[model samples]
Target chain A: MNYLHLLDYAGVAVFAATGALAASRLRLDIVGFIFFAAITGVGGGTLRDLLLGKLPVFWIKQPLFIGICVIIAVLVFFTAHLVESRYRLLLWLDAIGMAAYCVMGAMIGLEYGISPYAAIVTGISTATFGGIFRDVISGEKSVLLSDEIYISAALLGATSFVFLFSMGVPQIVAVFVGVLLAFGLRAAALLFGWTTPRYKPRQGRKIK
Target chain B: MNYLHLLDYAGVAVFAATGALAASRLRLDIVGFIFFAAITGVGGGTLRDLLLGKLPVFWIKQPLFIGICVIIAVLVFFTAHLVESRYRLLLWLDAIGMAAYCVMGAMIGLEYGISPYAAIVTGISTATFGGIFRDVISGEKSVLLSDEIYISAALLGATSFVFLFSMGVPQIVAVFVGVLLAFGLRAAALLFGWTTPRYKPRQGRKIK
Candidate 1:
């Protein structure tokens, strides 16, 4: 639980930084930057909570998360030059965040007594869908679709969490294994330049 | 029920056309056009359904909406010039779509036996949120938060729907009254250049 809490906080920090960095590139006003940062930090969790029928929302209930995200956004705002290699950092940091979120989400679902299959599905979705949404809103091709290993790795990690839990393994061991697997898979994909095949229209599918 | 179905179809067509028109402005590919159109057509309703605990998604269950969106996308793709004055047409067409969707969403909530207040909230959300998302994703400032009466009109309409329903009015009459109020309000706003005041930073809350 301690490790999970730490990782979740880390994930929030990284996601907030990514949002501020992206919004900065667009030369958004401070309010817009804050809005984007806040969205990136809590959007996935909010969506997950909404889907799971959890009320008041995670950030709404724990305003500390929102405060943390704002602080991170402000920090990034002042240190833009210091974080010049934003894209490179965003990629690796997001990988770590995704890994952590996958485990956290799956654990939360399990805690709520949801079915194992649904828990895994929700966990992976909570880990990756926010990035997908952020990219979509930013008018970029969703890395979730383009970067095949991202979502797939989260799914794998979440499924492993469920599997290990079902096998009477300790939560600590299950989380450790799940996070490592997701991080490992994502890192390998990045290092090896792995990609999914791009979707191409078939002959009969083109619009007239 | 008959009027509701008609309104749903009308809203779908208007939303799809507006989405396709917006995509054309970006000089996007056919796939992007289709994607945008489909998202515009069903995005709000899907969100409403998800929030209300409806599953499988309405569009997934009804392929007719998808087919229509695709057709609209194709039409706008080839006849881009036909939508040259997009901003003007978009406003009124969007109003119609908004009115219809608000009523339908509210009715759905009522059917599901949710609180009237929640139903009204869902209705307004369903009516305006897709456009908000569509604008945000395309890098355009969301019209909902801008100097526009968009969301407010939806709220007014939704409120009217609830009021009339509670007054023992026929369902069709209630819907008609709600839609007319929304449509008139939006048209007035567009013609008169009415706008909500922009949020200003509080005095002494100095933000850079």
Candidate 2:
């Protein structure tokens, strides 16, 4: 299989697993678990296709994606009790999925002749929108808006990939650099508890 | 004001009110209530615009939509007890909003020169997606899936409006017809307690 296809499968699997894990946390039924996984696994790509005016959508034409998601969801559902420390597993898997999606989205945008700036944004969006969607459906606030290196790391990775590709770097090399940048940044943030600064409003005072 | 603009305003108000009611049912905070209302009021249009590659999104460009939604949300939050028995009020409002979105979406789709079938589908999508989104976020099975007459009514209304416009009907007449169609269908369903057939799994009893 081509590198892109490999990355796509890996990304979809990781995303589906993470999504199922989240749904399991909610103690939802099997169908609900599969629904969450399927939505998260394909949501970003579906949105990208719709935006690009691609017809029929990606997952619709390829039933394999749905099948994979359902399989992962079912496996997770039955084995959830054996999985110790679900939070840690979900975090690491999500980070890996994030990197994969960012790189793939940037590659697709470039293939479609989108501007570099827009391509980078789309890449970051692809990496984060699925998690945001999962959170929203589960009635939780989106982690993307919180103090994290998530979107910023994806942005950096996408920029690096796009830049290297534009400079005639080999596709595999560009993807490696992008994924490493994202993974390293995310790991640093998690290990060090890096946070965005919060602004505090003055007590009993209005600041315009 | 142009008839189209007036209908759009009415639609926004109706959807915003329904969102507010749903938020109230969940006893969300003021911020949460307005957030839900704003999203439910404009989510469909935002999705449609994003799919059409419209920049900045619809509600982002027109902050008035958000402003109106917030006001309605605040009103609902403060007056929840009074409207608790006014569930029909919410339904009628939602119908109006769906109708307005259908017409506006159809108009934009036609302007963009999309195929007639796609335009009509887009219109229906633009009308119903907000409600689907609201239900998903609120952690309820979407009414769209179980409510038979709902989305279909919106589709019929939009198609009829487009057909009338193509036949040189006046814009005001088209709007009236669309709104009536959607509202009339919904009211009929409500009065008759109509619903889609529930999906049933095979019990698989061994034949003796």
Candidate-wise lDDT, in order: 0.76, 0.76
The DockQ figures for the candidates are 0.06, 0.06
lDDT, candidate 2, equals 0.76
lDDT (Cα, tens digit) per residue for candidate 2, span A1-208: 7888889888888888888887776666565566678768877776667655564456544657777888998888877666557766887888888899998888888888889888888788888887877777666667676676678788878999999988999999999999899878887877787765657757665654
lDDT of 1 by residue, B1-208 (tens): 5767778988988888778777877879999999888888888898787766677778889898899889988987898787658877766777788988888888887787766766776787689767866786677756554455666678778879988987899999998999899888888888897664433222222222
Candidate 1 residue A9 Cα shift, in angstroms, is 19
Measured against the true structure, the TM-scores of the candidates, in listed sequence, are 0.58, 0.58
In model 1, residue pairs whose N, Cα or C atoms come closer than 3 Å (at least 3 residues apart or on different chains), thus clashing, are none
DockQ of candidate 2, scored on C-alphas against the true complex (2 decimals): 0.06
User: What's model 2's lDDT at B3?
Assistant: 72
RMSD of 2: 9.2
